[model samples]
Target: MKQARPLPQYLVQRFQGWRATTFGENRSWYRRLAEGGQHPRAMVIACCDSRVHVTSIFGADTGEFFIHRNIANLVPPYMPDGQQHGTSAAVEYAVNALKVAHLVVVGHTNCGGVAGCHAMCSGHAPELEEKTSFVGRWMDILRPGYERVKDLPAENQIGELERQAVLISLENLMTFPFVRANVEAGNLSLHGVVHDIAEGTLKEFDPVSEGFSLVG
Candidate 1:
């Protein structure tokens, strides 16, 4: 018979290995960061995908971005009512407490959530209703995105779907009063980014250029 290994043992092994490598080289940097508290220049709202790591994708350091992760990286519309809004709470802390200079909504290609939305909107994947629950409400933020790219050609689906979602999220970010106030004051900037994990590339939405471009 095979023996069962405890989950805690595997976790300890991973932690110890990480400490030996990452902590060994930059002990002082991490130590200072822990002491100084989180003072990131930006706050990145990204998906909680194992493959889509925010810091790794941005080539950022430990304290560079105050990251908040959720399914599909959805940003709920700001509401005064007492709802269980974890994503909104994180955004509030990032904008109100951390006062980050930039707020970036990072979407990606081949996103299961976005793909599911495409299915739900198109009436092709009715199983979404029976199998998934939260995605219905969470993906409401991307309704405008669906409307924007609903009629695009099949070849352009990959590019347009992800692009439209990022644009919509960027617009939604402004709907938050704190985001709007800070942006109007010229103290805060908003950005939309899409990570193409398959191609190992990133596309950034350039406001000045008014289009998505490859990021070096």
Candidate 2:
């Protein structure tokens, strides 16, 4: 309880500035959103990378997306073992409660989580291999992705692995019974996209083509 602390001064000032400008100008919109509750059109599973601005990338406003951020933007295979599953819970709510039509998994370049998975798989990061490491356990969800790209040149693994993370998550999303039902009924769609940080471009996976294509 003692660990709680006040927000930094810069953030406080930034919030005040936003309240004065954005909030002041859009007060009615904010009020309507609060009253109506969130009915986002999509659910975005994305990396917790600070540089990945999911909202700005899609030109979406508040209440437009139900976003869940985690390391590597991974979705673990569905396990209804009565354990605490934050990502799964969010997926359930977005799929069942919110009834979102589109579910997008967003991955990005130079992801620290993907790199850690590579290091751990290659026995280079013993720290991440330990059972006590929360990050290690979480990154374990992407091991299948690492295994798929392990044989490629070391230089090529990172980028490919990043995309694999997105694909793997999309695959895992179907493991959820509710998600599977919705997809089967044509009520929901799954998508995977990788944002190239250096190039500022997006690549979307096409299941029919079995590859990713440039997105505008």
Candidate 3:
């Protein structure tokens, strides 16, 4: 019989600290949340990068934002093929069940996933070209975006591709009928954001300007 291992000491200590301090002071609020359930007004689809602190950036408390994180914050086109689609499922639940009023797709600078896609597309990473490479296969969703920036100089291409991730995800989100209907009815709004990791700066996409403006 196999035995289960204990959690890492660092994580255990951190959880204990939170339980004793943060949770202790907010016990009543936690209890209320447990009973009342979450009714967050926004759904944030952001990259699964440790540096991208979604709640911290927005100053959101627990249960305020329904967030889903994935590589490069990419959203594939809607495909009702009855396959397992984690991102799509999350989006569906957030839109239909949670009835979130806003949907935000966030991208970031120096993203590893975007870098990987760039490498693979530039014929620099032959290993990712193999059919068995999951990252490469998943990154196929960003090929269209990659094509748009492939012509730029190598140094400038990555940043443009990173921004493209947000644009592509926003464009793909509209492909969902529910998302489209809600957006058209003014029930939900879609936004694209990009975070500059090193500079601690944020930029919001403006459809009118067709560009990203730094958020003050």
TM-score of each: 0.88, 0.98, 0.97
Candidates 1 and 2 compared: the better one by TM-score is 2
* lDDT per residue (tens digit) for residues 112-136 in model 1: 8888878877777676655456777
lDDT digits (tens) for residues 1-216 of candidate 2 = 999999999999999999999999999999999999999999999999999999999999999999999999999999999999999999999999999999999999999999999999999999998999999999999999999999999799998999999989999998999999999999999999999889999999998999999997
lDDT for each residue of candidate 3 in 1-216, tens digit (9 for 90 to 100): 468888999999999999999999999999999999999999999999999999999999989999999999999999999899999999999999999999999899999999999999989998888999988988889989999999999789999999999999999999999999999999999999999989989999998999999999
Off by over 4 Å in 3: 1-4
Candidate 2 lowest-lDDT run of ten: 207-216
Give RMSD (Å) of candidate 2 vs. truth.
0.8
TM-score ranking, high to low: 2, 3, 1
Which residue pairs come into collision in candidate 2?
Answer: none
Q: Which candidate gets the maximum TM-score versus the true structure?
A: 2
Count of clashing residue pairs in every prediction: 0, 0, 0
Clashes of 1: 0
